[model samples]
Target: MAATAEKVKRGRKFAQVLEGARQVFLRDGYEGANVDEIAREAGVSKATLYNYFPDKRLLFLEVAKAECQRQADEAVEFDDGSAPPDRVLFAAGRRIADFVVSDFGQGVFRICVAESDRFPEIGQEFYRSGPGLVRRRLADYLREAVARGDLEIDDIDLAADQFAELCKADIQTRRVFRLPGCRSGETLDRIVRGAVEMFMARYGVKKGQTKA
Candidate 1:
């Protein structure tokens, strides 16, 4: 139908706008990015840009959501319970830690923190779309693991939160502050392995053991 075609076109245009907005935001930060530049970069007219996003804050929120969703889609994949708990946790933890320290991730986080006071909503949206989303997904995985007798978690949600925090450990803070010394793969792997070991120490169940 004509309406369906129009909707498809609009969705494509929206995706284009989001990609352009991401680039602008990453380069200029939220306070410095300009709508005109975003519109130009997206190859859309100013009117079209405005029509898609009513205000800069909403546009930025959408961009953050898209970025977070993309990361989740690519990195967080333990839903089907296909892999062993150790392997799943390590993969998920490493992915999260790497993303939190990546340039794009750091930029988005800095923008949220810098704009938090004036634009608290931006911070809230970022948390909801990023870390919060990841935590919830991890909690679901933990719950499933518990049901399978692989983990003996009494509080899956809290365990998920703890595991996430442990994975980040010192790396996230150092990266956020732009501290010296690059994190090599070995260092990251070591951190993730330690986190998994610590988690297993508390929640992991040996074979033939019942859930705690």
Candidate 2:
């Protein structure tokens, strides 16, 4: 168990280094970023960074994983048990929207798009973190709703991803591009409300009733 515990600690440290590398790379770009800088940012030694990651490319991938975990942790929620499905989804949507609209979110997304041609691995990792996490959590929620009889989903996972796409598509893209006049309190509210209505229209069913 000591070996296992040590491995876990090392893995966590590596993950932190990756996260630091990602932030620095996103802010400074690939050529400008350095492993030593990443180590300093992550509070690890240069030797430690190399102990976990042999190259900058691997560190970048790790960074993507860390970011994904953060977003996944933030966007997914436990059922309050009292609120309706739409309410729960809306709450989750709001959390996602808030993140997408932030400066750091935009920076990271920009890095993914800009660097995709040069670093396909990083691009894929970014996709896995952003869209991948969203889909997984949404699917899990939909499956739960199905079990609870709030929804009648034959394909819970796909339904969850689609639901998240519907909720986030506009805000996410616009925010990614830093579009002008693309958002306001009213806009976010409308987006959430519209997404909830659309989702319920498709998957929601009267309790205990099978799909028509």
Candidate 3:
């Protein structure tokens, strides 16, 4: 299993096939992803794609893992740990909101949900790379904030999870329920601010504290 997984990640055509699989799985999902469509998307022949991945499930899992890692790396790179809790939380919330409403995020989320029962590894990989990683990073910052007296929390993990939900819950439902079109950036900002305010109200060290 490990050997095949490594082979799937390496090779000249692996990058091409991975990107193609990412798109097709996001759009058509696990059960719906077609080999031919993925090949066409990659601008490669079916024979070439098969050289990297013989199993469709393996291909999809690799794609999900790659994409989630890509997003997580970007998040970590831009993250400012020295910032105040409110500022940090707001930034986290904004990033969550942006992804929740994005086409890629929504599609990947659906794939994880739809295939969780059948392909547990795919869902698990997605969580580890995406939400799990994000939550851990948030928890680390929350712990730091608590030490610095910026915030108070008994369970950093729970609070981190709660803050994450708070970021997208208010507005993500519309998208989850298949609401038409994209959400406006202004609307996303409003909800992110509201989430940060609510979180700070519960844990903030200062009263009437504004974002720093």
Top-scoring candidate (TM-score): 3
Model 3 TM-score relative to the real fold: 0.87
Ranking by lDDT: 1, 3, 2
Over the stretch 55-102, how does candidate 3's per-residue lDDT look in tens digits?
Answer: 787787677667867877855322345777777777778888888898
Q: For candidate 1, what's the RMSD?
A: 4.9
| Residue pairs of candidate 1 with colliding backbone atoms | none
For candidate 3, list the clashing residue pairs, or say none: none
List model 1 lDDT by residue over 1-212, tens digit each: 11222222245588888889999998798889999999999999888888777778778767766676665565466747777899899998998888777888888788877878876765776676678888888999999988887888888889999999998889888987889653678878999999999999898887776555
* Model 2: per-residue Cα lDDT over 22-47, one tens digit each: 77987887767877788888899998
Give the C-alpha lDDT of model 1: 0.80
lDDT of 3 at 191: 85
Question: Candidate 2, residue 187: CA error in Å?
Answer: 1.9
Worst 10 residues of 2 by lDDT: 1-10
Question: What value of lDDT does candidate 2 attain over all alpha carbons?
Answer: 0.72
Off by more than 4 A, model 2: 1-24, 31-62, 206-212
Question: Between the candidate structures 2 and 3, which one is better when assessed by TM-score?
Answer: 3
* Model 2 C-alpha RMSD to native: 5.4
